[model samples]
Target: MFGDLTGIMGKLKETQKKIEETKKRLDSVLIDESSSDGLLKITITANRQIKAVDIAPSLFEDREQLEDYLVITLNKAIEKATKVNEAELASVAKDGMPNIPGMDMFK
Candidate 1:
């Protein structure tokens, strides 16, 4: 029983180490996402901070349309980036938690 407990403790420690390492790596990983019309794009880090946004000048011809497009495009890019970040975190967490099914809370 003592040996089993010790072994489990060691495993837990190893899992924690992997999780930390994954977080560090994810922090530096960037996800580039764009909109459907290619009029807007964004680069975001896994931590959800916007790095850059690209807007095509032609979209600015109509102010209202431009505003709507900007909102929609930015939303799409952010949503896509968030999904990418979640996927990455999920992959990393899965490596350490193979036995626990669908444990995506860490992402």
Candidate 2:
């Protein structure tokens, strides 16, 4: 039993390392989103860091409209980034998990 526990602990450590690596990798994974009218564009990383924002000249005519577009587009970009981050981290965790009785958390 002690041997099994030791192996499990080792596996958990490895999984944690993989998760950190994945998070670092996610920093480079870009997600692009734009407004419905294509007037605003946003680029963000899977880690939810904004990389760039492109807005059309026409959007500058109305401050409120521009703000709304920014909010909507940024929210969409963040949502996409969140999904990618979660999926990648979950996959690493699930794959690295050691099979133990009643420990089927991934299921």
Candidate 3:
């Protein structure tokens, strides 16, 4: 029984190590999320850092148009970012838990 417990413990430790490693890999990686019907653009890192932001001249010409498109584009960008991040994370945890409880929000 003691030997079995040790084996289980070792497995758990390995799992935890894998999880930590995956998280570290994710942190080092970056996900670029941008939006702009060819106008406003942005690059976001995996850690949620804004790498770059650009705005086109035409984007400022029409305030209303810019605002509407900016909102839509930003929404789309954020959605894309979330999906990409989740997919990357999933790729790391291929054999572990699909969606850890309470950790769903992070994904």
Q: Which candidate is the best by TM-score?
A: 2
**Considering lDDT, where higher is better, how would the candidates rank from best to worst?**
2, 1, 3
Superposed on all Cα atoms, model 2 deviates from the true structure by an RMSD in Å of: 0.7
What value of lDDT does candidate 3 attain over all alpha carbons?
0.64
TM-score of each: 0.66, 0.97, 0.60
> Per-model C-alpha lDDT, please?
0.71, 0.96, 0.64
Candidate 3 clashes: the total is: 0
TM-score of 2: 0.97
**Candidate 2, 17-54: lDDT as tens digits:** 99999999999999999998899999999999999999
Q: Which stretches of candidate 2 lie over 4 Å from their true place?
A: none
- Model 1: what TM-score? 0.66
lDDT of 2: 0.96
User: Which digits, one per residue and each the tens of the lDDT, describe model 3 over residues 26-73?
Assistant: 565655544534677766555445666677888788999888776776
* Higher-lDDT candidate of 1 and 3: 1
Instruction: Indicate which candidate wins on lDDT.
Output: 2
Question: Where does candidate 1 have its weakest 10-residue lDDT segment?
Answer: 98-107
